[model samples]
Target: MAQSSRRSSISGPSQHNALVSQNQVVLYNASSKGLTVNYIHPACHTVEEPDASTCPYCHRPLDEYNHSAPQAPTSDHRAPNYFHLLAIHNESTSRPLTPPHLEDEARPPLSSETMAEGYFDAFFREESKLGMGANGSVFLCQHVLDGNLLGRFAVKKIAVGSSHKYLVRILKEVRLLETLRHPNIITYHHSWLEPCRFSTFGPSVPTLFILMQWAEGGSLDDFIAQRRGISHGDTYQNSASPESEEAHMTKAQRIAAFKARTGAGASGTSRPANLKAVHLLSTDEIVSLLWDITSGLAFLHNRSILHLDLKPGNVLLTWDPNVLIPRGMLSDFGAARDMLHQGSRTGVTGTLEYTSPEIIMPDPMTGALRQTDSKSDIWSLGIILHKLIFFHTPWRNGNDDFSLLEQEVIAYPGFIPDPSITSACSRRGLPTELLTLLQSLLDRAPGRRPSCEKILLAIEEHK
Candidate 1:
């Protein structure tokens, strides 16, 4: 690649801008800074690097998947691990996500030839809204077979524009979700794409519909609140107490308790509180929850998958329809990606508070984003564990999550749990092995972190 003899290196907003493509990647000059913008990163200075440079972010080569590695698994899992599902989901009334978890007709025919009505509309009927978020809304829908209500499921609807970038995200999520069959992970049943036009007409916007198992028990955040005791308004608490008092509480009782405690009649279902619930969990409850999540992560990382967002919100709880016991199941595949896939490693890809230090900081030598791998997931899990034990993450010592994360990212290569928090877990009978494992998971050096399988096996021994 060669550049013209005439070049400008303006520092601020200038009038000139030009697109530059090099080594199969496109770069552009900013009008103000005369900086090179990366193909994915816009308005950045010298963000595009040599195509041959390995990504400090994902730890993969700049080039996309180029090797004859194992082919990524498809939606149809050839070798299903029913035994894992049998352990938890089957114990109660759980069936395969089809048995594990639709259709609408008589609608004005879609004009877009590419609309996926043939697959999605033919089988599923969207009902009431179950949940909504910044990116999408989830609906409780019925799977219809020959006009019969086959079962109930949660369908996530994400609005998208017509673009390969958006399509890749949907495909990546579905493909990744499809391969995961562990009971601890939410079951992905089906997916479809449709045009975004019904009444309002404009450019043909696309949409994605992902059908997944409904976690009737809600998010782990709610579970933590229920197990811990939440209240409305200003609050103060450090640990989950009332373990003995809450021992006999069923999901209904706990939800009721949370409502009563949080003055839900005055407001609504409990919102996230900085304070912990009054009741702390017993050693057994804590162990079971930890084991469940650890097993789920093990299953994921074993397949070279990275759950970039492993926050409490994504860890859902679902009761066995038959047994009535609560089980922690991982959900939300939006930020997940295959490490072995074809592509350069990703940039920092998670909530800042839960993001690993390595991902936040840049490499001193390369002056680029530091390489982050599956070990980053381990760091996130360690933070989740801390939140479970201490009832909150010390992302920052001063004001808020952002500040806490800022403090840590700025102080990369150095982070340790507050000794008091670890001490509390110890008081609650967190075994020495498990505690060490936790520390290792959060090790500042990514290489020092244990594998998901090792964490699983070690914790199993403690259990």
Candidate 2:
């Protein structure tokens, strides 16, 4: 008697068994839309159609497919598209079925709780307006959570419909600030994207708020004016002879006499004696201030950054009187750029008076204005130094003649006062080494100018 062949039972409605050999059973699934079934082989397991009806090696029924046709010896070699099928097979149960949706309620939605605590409240609170600029308004905000005085921060709420270039420039400034960390450089504390709250705007536009350490003394330009007034008063009081009010009287008389005398002259030149009353800085103080500024610039340049706008307004003094020298902190990194190895070129950047000649003059060979690089920054620094010492910019009195201005700058290279003046008309005469350093820094050719490190070294050696 022949041995009875045992057939394997299907576990689900989608699952079915097909005969592989006399004793072997293969599981498979029938296509729900059609009578055709997909064959799943048990050994050398794969989903495919069998050829002919008998197994290729075993010479038995191709039980992989659930069909009345005779088993094929070999399986049809074709790739299967699993995506089309709605069911997946379970290896353990040998069944085809759908699984549960585990992701539906796995996580909770984020509400006001998940957000930064007190952020919304602090952002919405009424802030004391501090300053306004082209981009946005600054507000002195109170930290809601800690109640800590978040020292004078500028809440720069950007304007909507702003040009892409302006936005890019603003972002670059922020990025530059982010990488920069120095004592002299302004600190960029934090910045964040917030919804615009202006009454005129629709729904909400994207606005960026930058938190920075505010300069208490305002711009260097204002500071210089204040200093000038104080210095003038000090000069008047000190020069007043104690022995006789007559000395002061004579000084005033000589000035009036000189003005009367000069009334007949067409030329604007005044007598040296009349100009003697001008209270200029002592040589020592001027040199010291120059030294301080150069040191700040050196630090910035060593870090591969250029202060494109180095002027009186940008150099800030910390508010401490005992600190004899102006402990200057370089502000406004907005125009700064990396220039360790780049060549100098001129472009329409920086203040006109402080802008370098290389920027103003186009290179004949390239026919392009040199991009203001590190050397261009040095030129600006030289101008700033001249202003700090002389209390006047070199280009202040220049007529609208571009060629004449260029010639004057090229000829002088640096500040050039009359050689015959006996009095210390400017800040006390700077030391020889300091003066030499300034001259070198203010060279006509960018290549001729000394590196910021060299300048720092010279200052230290002189000290």
Candidate 3:
């Protein structure tokens, strides 16, 4: 539950959902009915955009429709005329990958045959909300027959009312997940389309279901919050709830006690059983966790996959199962891309705060803006490192959005970790090597950043 709260929310401050990945690209027309569109990149899955006609695969316009497009789909069961135009739009734009969503030609694409409603009704039960995205909701699922012994899974469901592109992106995500196999990445179990059997509203929307490996430990942010005894909402700040002072004080006292027990103020004290943050984790262990991420990234890059978004929330944490230890794994391929098909784009697609300087900047030759490459992902990884060690972001310009934009533009390789981290690390003579490595990783120029393999090696040497 703690992990569920700290999404790198793409939506506005007032909005949140369990399923949506980020804010949907809402398109409104006062003259005509408002049309809202949100899609996983049709081919690359790099970025989610507003209601633009750009083909996510080629990053161009969907100029024409295919002759044999599926009829407009209706949310109502087996209905007509409801989604005809959406079908045309999706079918026309959806581009198949080279191996067509497979690692190699030996494997075939997963069939689009959706699972029937009875399967879910009989097997799985909703335990709680996991997370939300622009177009869907994710739930913690429990197996009815197996109890908790078999472990749990997260199931994400997208409604049929979403734009045709939205559904197609999900289809592509399923295919992509099927192709990917890595220990540091979220494991995809099963995905299928199912009719909503429970909703009382107008024609039941066809829902896309993706069952994923449940990282019971939650996201990286959540793990940090839990280890630090920090509240999920209003983090790295005064997170006291408006409801009661006693509970807040109790939490504060617990944190203080935890810090005291862990001896975070001392130099290289032994790790406490409950402590899991900067104080407890060894540089070796931390790098090992980082190795998990880098290995996962290497796997993606090897397959020509680019995980455009690499924030704390996107990197999930699961229990070791053998023990309570937290192990890192990458999740949420909604913003992932297939580099084999689409080249970098000039448009910015990720969160502004974590975005690299080069992503929003223009190329010298093309003069086109927002072109990002693998190095962009490295920049994001640098920010996550800052947060992990410093307990805050390096770009602390101000609270409002404008300041954030300013920080993204001017923030550079020279910026160090927060002053708090500096003080602590200075006392312990720690984070010295790690921060120095991060400087290279977070370089403003993409070409200056290190590759995934080198990062892993660097972490290994530091250990």
Candidate number of the best lDDT:
1
After superposition of all CA atoms, the RMSD between model 3 and the true structure is: 18.7
RMSD of each: 22.4, 27.6, 18.7
Cα distance off (Å), candidate 2, residue 316:
2.2
Model 3: how far residue 417 lies from native, Å = 6.7
Where is model 2 more than 4 Å wrong at Cα?
1-150, 154-165, 196-205, 230-279, 282-288, 320-322, 340-346, 398-413, 421-433, 461-463
lDDT of 3 by residue, 295-335 (tens): 88888888888888887778888665364456788887777
Query: Candidate 1: deviation at residue 398, Å?
Result: 9.8
Candidates' lDDT values, in order?
A: 0.58, 0.51, 0.57
**Top TM-score: which candidate number?**
3
- When 1 and 3 are scored with TM-score, the better candidate is 3
- Regions of model 3 farther than 4 Å from truth: 1-115, 145-150, 197-203, 232-285, 321-324, 343-346, 364-366, 397-403, 416-423, 429-431
TM-score of each: 0.61, 0.56, 0.62
Q: Give the per-residue lDDT of model 1 (tens digit) for 1-463.
A: 3321111111123322121122112122233222233332321213354432343223333323323223222221111322122122222322112211112223333235435534455556878887677668888887553354445678887775545455555666776777667778988755555655434656545677677778778877776666555542223222223442343468788777767755677457556566453566555666677788888888887787888888787888876545444788888877787777736554667777677887777788987876457888888898787677656664433224456546755574443545764776688776556557667877887898888777777767656
TM-score of 3: 0.62
Write candidate 2's Cα lDDT for 1-463 as tens digits: 2221222223247644432223243445654322123233443332343443444334444343334322111222111222112122212221121111223333343222212222334423446775565557766564321232212344556652323445455666676675555556555555544445567756545455566555555555555555545332233221112212222247666555556644534354644443323345556556565666777787777778787878776676555345565556676666777776545553566655677777777778978876666798888877766556655556522334556656655555564344432234423555555556656766778898877667667767655
lDDT: the better of candidates 2 and 3: 3
